[model samples]
Target chain A: MKQRTRFSRTVVGGAALSLMLSLSGCGAGSDAADGDTIHVLVYGDAANKVEKELVATFNETSKVKAVLDTIPGADYQAKLQTIINSKQAPDVFFNWGGGSIKPFVDAGLLLPLDPFIAKDPGLKAKFLPSVFNSAVVDGTSYGIPMRGTQPVLLFNNGKVLKDAGVEPPETWGDLLAAVEALKADGVTPIALGGGDRWPTLMWFEYLYDRIAGPELFRKALDGDREAWASPDSRKALGKIKELVDAGAFGTNYDSVKFTDQGSPTLLATGKAAFELMGSWEYSTQQDAHPDFAKSDLGYSAFPSVEGGKGDRANLVGNTNNFYSVLKKTKHPQAVAEFLKLMYSDQFVKAQLGIGNLPTTTNTERFLDTAASPEFAKFQYDMVKAAPAFQLSWDQAYPQSAATPMYQALQQFFNGSMDEDAFIEAMRALPAS
Target chain B: MTRTATPSAADGTFDKADSPGIGAGRPGFLWAAPAAVFFALFAIVPLIMVAVLSFARWDGLSSPEFAGLDNWKLLFDDPVMIKSLWLSVLLTVLGVLVQTPLSILLGVWAAGHQRNRAVLSAIYFVPMLLSVAAVSVLWRAVLDPNFGVPAQATWLFGDGNLFGTQAGAIGVLVFVSTWQFTPLHTLIYQGAARAVPQVLYQAAQIDGAGTVRQFVHITLPQLRNSIITSMILMVVGGLTTFDTVLILTQGGPGSDTTISAYYMYQKAFKSFDYGSASAIALLLVLVSTLISLIVVRLSGYDKMRSTMEGL
Candidate 1:
């Protein structure tokens, strides 16, 4: 018995030792190869496909190899946080260039790219000012502009509007008229997904920004201005109440899951007249309802509010989703080289072909100037017009404050709290 | 070194010396040394670390600040945390109250002269076999407002939105949890019921006792230990329910079904507030421990053990 026990113990110990040695060997091997590879982490299914193709293209031409790690949108933050905490952050990772990256930048986890930008005169001149400015923190650029997405008024087919005998709304009064027309025809005018707080907040933001103007919006977020007491903010709240009173949104909107709800489909099928959604909705709408072409879609900013300084062109957007390099990258030069490749003409064309809005100076050249005449017109107008661009409210504030702000907005939309309560809650948000 | 040699008897057997080493034997401590070391390293060390972290303020990135009782104090003031804890307790109590008796009944029914017992058990146990993610996705589709089974049912029978209210959502969650867990407890109870002596049943039959009487008197008493074991398991499992709730509601429509475990995850991972998360975890552990002790004592496990030993 003793002999058998000793033998078994020796066998177990030997197995453990071998396992440890193998683990150590794998670690060492990875460390040795880390010099050659530029690990990039990104989020979203669409971004994953694009990134994979980009990486493959880069590997074919460049001396350094590129690896793309695609994390799910929901899990990306947690995964990135873990990697950062472990000091095993990837060479390049997706970042929301505003306050989301502020924490990482402040911790010195991100590599500042002003020095790189200064050396590359082509890159310095090619990037959009808004995109470049979004990445700059305390006079240093820490991220590269990837894509830009902004909210636009998306409307359904001619059936709903034709039945209502109303043209596309260009002003707040026109919109109200359209809503009234739709109500007369016994059709829901606006299809809003209050279940997803973000969508509800988007409408709130558009109204609030239009009412309060860009300066007050920024001031309110910074706590320099109180939203609860502001008459403009209250007016914005009243607009939401107006929509609710008009029965613009569906019944039991609070309980519906955002992804499962068929608001996009409703628009495609002409069940709903219009939807206020981000530009990404184009892709999702096309995917869900293939019959609905890009031509069928009309793009407009939120209708101009009466007696408000905000115009139709005063857009609310941010170059929030961008990419940055980690300071601890073994191959910073290689990573930078890869990033340069991403900004190349071929990559830009590929990104643009997929309907992504590139933040480069060459955006106009790649856009569907012929196919999407309305979008082309909007782009041209934007270039000629110098309307103030406001950053997304959630992205502008620190995450600690921003998360609860979203929850509060959700609560407000769900009818648990009024607009005054929401503004007060926003006022009470802790400073980061 | 007072060495003394004891003389043997006339039988020629040498007398062994009763030295301290011989009396005690070479200390038995060495035999238990490895296991103790391993237990201390793996279990005790981690527990100590968690306990220490519970008192400190951390963001899971920078070095943790020693905030004394700040995290614990915050727990009392945090409405979300308190609500989540209450929700978890409510879920646990409801799961036990509904599931335990239902599982026992199913176990008893399956153990009777039922020919399709194996097939029925297999069908019932399928949900338990599925991954939580798979189950959640399947249920999400079934509960979808536009095209799901529940929605379809509601449209056919009653209202069009079965999951449109907080109470309805919670009911669906509870139902799903109970359905998934009942099979496991049923199987456990069935096995225990199978182990009860056939002679007891025969003796009851000879006494003119009916089938119901046999079950109530003979079978139930025999399966008491199993029932207690399964109930404890169910309570513990229910207390930490997260994945299904996360996939379904994400503590939605105003934090309706936000259990303590989900709250902990949202704080520690989503919001990166590790300090409060750790405190919540510590509180969860304490509550679970207290409930478990009370349950075990009330179930008369010790008495059962003594009786079994006496038998």
Candidate 2:
């Protein structure tokens, strides 16, 4: 039996295979970084409006135009890491500084801002020194403070506190007392978004700083394992365990999330009396429950511990968001000009107008022009007066340490892990 | 005049050219080439990359350096990894146990031509219509301990902290998946049940068999092939379940609901431990493939005997 020739079919099949292979290659490809405009990628949110305005303001006079790109807040970090080394990497990008930029710094993907600082001293002199220092990896400046400082604060619903006859806690004893009063009044003493997990980390950050001072944490973050097992660490964990046992956060906290406004809504509806959160809670409240924000939202520094080593004036949270440059950017001069806008009067006013407390030295001058001058002054003064402002433990650690750390935090809060295990987890984190 | 010799292409595709008149209608290898090519590009190539990455110490940044078997070694020694594997197996087993009987019953009931049955079946299928992510989000909002249905129905939810403990988180994960996936499996069984000849039921009735007896003696035996198909799907789906766990519990209240799939994601994206994540991925592939092969073998599913061959 003679078989018919099938060479034509084989060729067609090969052609189809190659065609699809090329198509799939296109799917994996990215846009070439050859544009005249410098792309400034930022964390997208209500904050994008200010970034857009800044980019537009920069484009008015600069020869190399500026373009604003934003990845939504939840996805910004993961997406940035995926694109940072690719052709699609932005010319300048927003970051939380510290370990957020450390990976990129180690990879040599970030451009040090020292040259720009050398040419224009105001670029370094303008922003708060502490905020600027956050982006300095190994004493080389790699970032410029762009937006605002977010110090952890004890926020409350004024009506709930009044109804319960409870004051915002001024000391650990007072906070414990307030928790009892709030619990008796049938309002959750603290609205914790344990499901979101990072909110749980906030409690740990403040408690550790309050009990042991920022030095212990700074030591621990610098790869000193002994710091996590120190007496102060256990004391902080003991205090957290005390508060949790006293039902400060209530029973259903693990099911609540900040991203969905679960815990904030608890405060808004007076179901909860307090939420210890970042300065951004002000903006969050104002956006979600305008009536509550207008009349009943109250803020104060985290309560002090009576015999604690830490000073009451010490703060812990994100110092500020920063704009870090890419080493591969062809338009360094243009990028520097755009970063200059970060410290400009227009930038401060726009930031203040949106309720973000810019960390610029000139931020004090624009305080009166703020959306809520009173609120802005409260944050600005606290930031200025803080003896030491520790960055959040998650942001302070390298990116790889985040999950295990968050898991540890959540486990400790939920009674899944004891203090020892929590300490061991913290000790195992990649400190560099 | 009948020649049983098979005429294959040069590539040995087992062509039917020597068969009487059947060869004329047979399409060439080009017909399947596109699909083969697409699968190779999307699935096979990425799978190969994952295998290579499993042996390397790459953090998605910097050039990968060979780490030999370090990732695999760490995975074996890790308690969380071991727990995740056990959790994956438990969830898959629970899914099969819960879904098989429920879908079979629902499928048979829905096979009726009654108007209400048709309406109810359509309603049941709505959850399947929603994307897994969308369904997860919807359920999360609906089941929120404070504002969700649990708050209103206190007796049912008992403090409503469904994500607070290991048992509760796993329960939510399993329950949410069962809610979203039962309809698909039910559809499979429904079609299979419909294909079961009416004559067998009539014969059973004539023999004085009750509804239960007919279902057991006639309908179920006919549905043997579909049971295997649907079971394979459920086992694979359960093992790889990620979205429901992610959106509902986030493998949280402290890694309580950390199934292998979600654990792998946490490693890759959250922790940036790409090597370990790739190892976990390769392990998952091996496990599901092994489980499916075993299931097919045990059921004698590859024997390829038609249920209607006698008729």
Candidate 3:
């Protein structure tokens, strides 16, 4: 009985010790914020250099010191999701505005920025309306556009296109013709990073927008299952099938990835004619294949679908990265002051210098200061003129929908799932 | 980090309990209190939390709500969940089949006292030193369709499209894990082979047995203890294969290689369905534990007889 008592006592003590340990672990976040510093969490990348500079600039005059906390690489979103509601949640954090922040807003963890925008009209007026509106959750402002917009473009290797005697395609028919030419010339018609499933999603986004005028996708996202089964959706899928059967991306695209420089290398090496990628492809090319970027990198809007309901000017990609504040933050004034830097002249110049297309109205004046002024002008004009800018399907849909959506898209593209199967899969996704 | 380390949680407890312990010098429960507390803290506590979470509905952002058997019911109804479990079993079976013979042959070969064999053995041990992440990344770069070794050896790799097909992707995964992990098993077999009585080999030689017969008759029976240990490790390792799938294939061309562990990660991080993910995790823990137990029971390893006895 004495031994039993000792064992039970030890267990209680150990449980207490472990409970204390875990409690301390949970408390580590509150310790990080303390009284003076506002933790500014951002995705760690080359762009962080600019974010770091802005944080330093914020600290110069504000009574509250802004401490930059960065979570790097592919795990950024996962890390953010885990910590967003915890005591460790930052005062302000970076996000891709759209379905990305909807859950946070739904949970009431995000501070609506209407009050901030009310105090300073520039918070809303300083940025492009299209980019600004992406972060609006159910008609309430939740994000400030911090980084530039990344509208997807059809990037072509000039040398390969010329060798195939094809131009940068401006219409669906021309693109098909270019694919035939490039294939005949012994190059992959278009390099696709299908291994990274999100890149494969780009085709659907643009095609759906062009064929169904974005209304079908909007309806589908709003929980209308009929939207996916509609003729427009089937037509979009048919077009994708025709392109695949034509061997436009070759037979081995699933073996290639954009993130690992596989598809980009094919374009740079004159082995592939075209790659539909975001505006950041410019900087990516500049960094990895400067010679090719200088001499032959050409980009155009996704080709217009013939007789499509959507305007030719419709764009799809990441609209912009946003700075969203936590509702529980004590430093709303400091965070507001920090968000103001997003539209500042210094921020625009820094972003442009790094080849980012800032969406600020002041962004135009700094276009000449861009790393590639020609590229910058193209993206800016396209964005300014676009009737609709659809976010990537993976980003626009709630996070829960991403896995099955990716599976369906990949299977359909790879011949594992037929049109109806793909439609059913899309219909089954949990609507936001 | 959670991928390869998860099943080891169950494996570790059993492994320690199985290790020989007895007599006067044996530490009391008081001496083990610290380690037990640590185990409770890191392993048992978290496992209980996961078990509790498995029956709840959580998206990580919102607070968890009791969902009764909903997550389990949902898992049972999910075709992908069923497929993922099959994939995990297939990969594990393939790992055991491909790795066992190769490691045994290499192990026995290196057990010989040739000086050159020492150098070769050191070289063979290189993969054992690499983390699963590093190994997966290295192989991913090497197997890249357009730019990697597959491109350089087009005749061998056939357009370098190994990741495009189900068979090809599974082949690469099995081959890579075999390459990265066989060395450790080889080292185990080597140690066990060395412990086999030299007298048995001498007697076999006197009976005009060749090297092959000596290995089959003498070395095989002697290495039974090590075989069970190595096989258990392999079983657990294969069941929880996450990083390699994440890095190399991401369970694609279309859920073709979606092992349960990787699927659990997808449910948790990608889908934000922590409840379902926890359910999947618990299922994995159960599967790995059951498989390990079966291996022990069938192999009679739980009896813990001395291979060194009857000298």
**What's the lDDT for residue A240 in model 3?**
94
In order, the TM-score of chain B in each prediction is 0.83, 0.91, 0.91
The reply for model 2, stretches above 4 Å from the true place, is: A1-35, B1-26
iRMS of each prediction in angstroms? 5.5, 4.1, 5.4
Cα deviation of B204, candidate 1, in Å: 3.9
- Can you write out model 1's per-residue Cα lDDT over A279-398, one digit (the tens) per residue? 666667667765674546555567878887676666665543678888878777777777786567776666666666666777667676323445644643563353665666777665
User: lDDT score, residue A248, model 1?
Assistant: 75
For candidate 1, please provide the TM-score of chain A on its own.
Answer: 0.85
* Candidate order by decreasing lDDT: 3, 2, 1
lDDT of 3 by residue, B27-119 (tens): 357745665777887899999999999999999988899999999999999999999999999999999999999999999888889879999
Write down the worst ten-residue block by lDDT for model 1 chain A.
A368-377
Question: How much lDDT does each candidate structure score?
Answer: 0.71, 0.88, 0.89
TM-score of each: 0.85, 0.93, 0.93
Clash pairs, candidate 3, are: none
User: DockQ for model 2?
Assistant: 0.49
